[model samples]
Target: MSELTLAIDQSTQGTKILLVRQDGTIAYKITKNHQQIINPQGWISHDLTEIAANLKFLIRKALSHAGDAAIKAVTISNQRETAAAWSRRTSAPLALAIVWQDNRTTKVTEQPNIKKREKIIKYKTGLPLSPYFTASKFNWLQTYEPAVQTALSTGDLCLGTIDSWLLYLLSEGTYKTEPSNACRTQLMNIETCEWDPELCEIFGINPKNLPTIVDSDSNFGTTTLFGTLEKPIPITSILGDSQSALLAENCLHPGEIKVTFGTGSSIMMNTGQKLLRTKNGLNTSVAWKRKGKTTYALEGNVNYSGALISWLKDRLKLINDPAETDEMAQAASKNDTTFLIPAFSGMAAPYNKPELKAALVGMTPLTGRNEIVCAALDAIIYQINDIISLMCQVFTDSKLTLHVDGGMIANQYLMQRLADIVQCKVLISPIQELSGVGTSLNGMNNQTLTLSVSKTYKPCLDKIQSQNQVKIWANNIKQLTK
Candidate 1:
């Protein structure tokens, strides 16, 4: 019988379950989107119960078509930094999962105590003292949510990212998290790969409430998915979604890079074994840890990328579907100079301004739906180009080529525009769901699996034109910030 690995990618938007064959191809795939719960106060959240139920639904739906293939292992890749708190005794969630995009803890992060320790926190965690990470969200829950408070008082609080929550659910109470997810929490020390007590104290999170840190390829435990499968299978691997995409793109060597254009964009360059801290706005994080060896990466995050398209579709009603963006952008007037800065959740990386709101500039009477759509697409490309330029400064010796994946890459116009603006070759992954594939590859221990690029986008604009475009974007950004 053939062997298969069930890989689950629980991301910001939805949960995807894939039955991956030994050769790294998906045998069966199913995805179910959960509700994006936004409170009246504008705090974004995820119903953990809904997400867990969706995962169960996808698993059962995918496995029904597995035929007689032996299900060998289960792996997970999840949205990093989304915080969750639950009961250690009852295994019930204490509160809704606070999204990484939610900035409800901004006030907490700006407190006199936390502000004074910003440098120390960044030094220890390799991340800025911002509410964008898991630590502040955990703190917010502990302080504001009544159930979380009650759980904490009774010592029943289990604080973790989405991976640990799902791991606890699937592995029957194994409270564990891997480095890729842990590093983003602003609680783990990047050097030691353990929860730093000082950093934890700074965020008012007890180290004991956190999950056990483990290697990315560790066998977390076995799960039968609450009897969804015929037998219990070992849960073998876990990684944050961006790091998983890095592994899927074969960016194992120093200076290699991958860009994941998901709900948000993460531009990560593998720094190999060395942990390099940056004075610039870029974040240094553990790419993954395996076999007692840890790999580090420099990451620049864009708070809005594909989410911009969703906004345009769902809110503005400019486009009925995300796929329509390509054709609409292509049809837009060439002379239109409208630019959009999608800082809806505030800008990240190079300019970590959570205070700035989004803007649309340089609009003319000629600007219409097509032009606005084009601008929105260009906004995503410009944000990515900003990070790519920064990475170029850090790795000056290497020529950067972005190995790209995620739903947004399907937009041909956007990919070409990214190539033109960044003035580099862009390679698109054949598989849209690389996070799941990467986790499955790690679970199977298949180092020799070849990754095939389905398409390549080369720079079409001349050097001068590309430079001018970048300058225009920079100017717009300066105006927004000013």
Candidate 2:
């Protein structure tokens, strides 16, 4: 019998279950999307029960195809910074999970106390004071939801990111989270890799209520998928989804980069063991911790990337399916000067203008749906280009290689545009289950895992054209901000 690993990726849009073989190849996969619960106030949330149920369904579906006997170990890569509070007694969620993109906690950062400590918070956490992290989300719950406050006061609260929630459930109440996820909570000290007491106090979070921090490759305990497995399997690996994708791309060396284009795009550059704090709005995060050693990354997050396409489909009814976007963009008139700023929730990193709203500029009589779609694609590339420029400023290493993945990579035009704007080679991996492949590889690192590239895009646009486009986009952004 062959040894196979089950990797679960719980993301904002859905839950994906992957079956990975011993040699880093994905054999089978299943994806299930849960509802995005949004209130009239525009706060985003998820039902913990629904997500947990989806995981079971996916695991059962995969086991039916691959057989339960073939699986030996389980690994996880989950959405980061989405937090929730649950009871320690019955394990029921006190409230809906506060998604990473939720802007409900925007007021939390504006408090006089929090604003005064922004510098100290950033110095320790390597993250900007924003509602997009876990700490603010947890604080929001405590202030508004009576049940959350009750649980916290009674010592029955388990407050953490989605990974910690899933870990607690999978381990039958272990209440643990790995560094990659914990670092994003804005509560962990970047250098020490431990929860900062001062940060917790500032955010009104108790250290005892948070999950115990563990290494990414540590033994997370055993599970049978709620009694689906014939015998219990060990859960050996856990990572934030973006970090897992970086690991999957095999970006272990400093200056190696990977960009995951999902609901939001996370662009990360491996900075090896040393921490390089950035003044350019890029985040310094723990890439992973293993065997008591740590590797760090400089990351820039875009709150809207692939989610823009979702908005076009669901909200604007521009297209019936996302796959049609590539064709529509290609059909757009080249002379059309339409451009879109996809700051749907808020712009993050480099341009941390959370108060600035989204804008679509340069529309004229010739503008059509296809032109708007094309502009949306261009906006995604431009947002990435902004991060690329920041990376160049911080690390002058000319050998930076970028590896790309996720659902958006299927569009060849976007890939080529990204290459042109950045003026570098963009390599796309053929691996379908990228995060799963990464976590599995990290857990089983003794084997020599090889990374193969399926496509490489080179810059075709000249310097003048690239600069002009960027200038025009910047001018439009300035107009909107004004």
lDDT of 2 by residue, 1-482 (tens): 88898999998999999888999888898999999998887889999999988988888899898964478898989889899889887788899999999888889988999989999999999999998898989888989999999998899998999888887887788888888999999999988889999999999999999988988998999988878876888888999999999888888888889999998899999888979898998999999999889999989998887888999999999999999999999899989999999887788888888787888889999999999999999999888889878987887772556799988999988888898888889999887568878888877853435777889999899978998999998898889888
TM-score of each: 0.98, 0.98
Candidate 2 matches the true fold with a TM-score of 0.98
lDDT of 1 by residue, 1-482 (tens): 99999999999999999999888888999888899898787788999989878888888888888999988899999999899999999789999999999888889889899899999988988888888998889989999999999999999999999999999999879999999999999999999999999999988999999999999999999999879777798999999999998998888889998989999999999988878888888899999998889999989998878888889999899999999999999999999999998877778888898878888899999999999999998988888888878877876655589899998888889999989998889999988899999988877774534777899999999989999988999999998888
CA lDDT of 31 in candidate 1? 85
Candidate 1 TM-score, true structure as reference = 0.98
lDDT of each: 0.90, 0.88
Model 1 residue 30 CA deviation in Å: 0.4
Candidate 1 displacement at residue 474 in angstroms: 1.1
> What lDDT, from 0 to 1, does candidate 1 have?
0.90
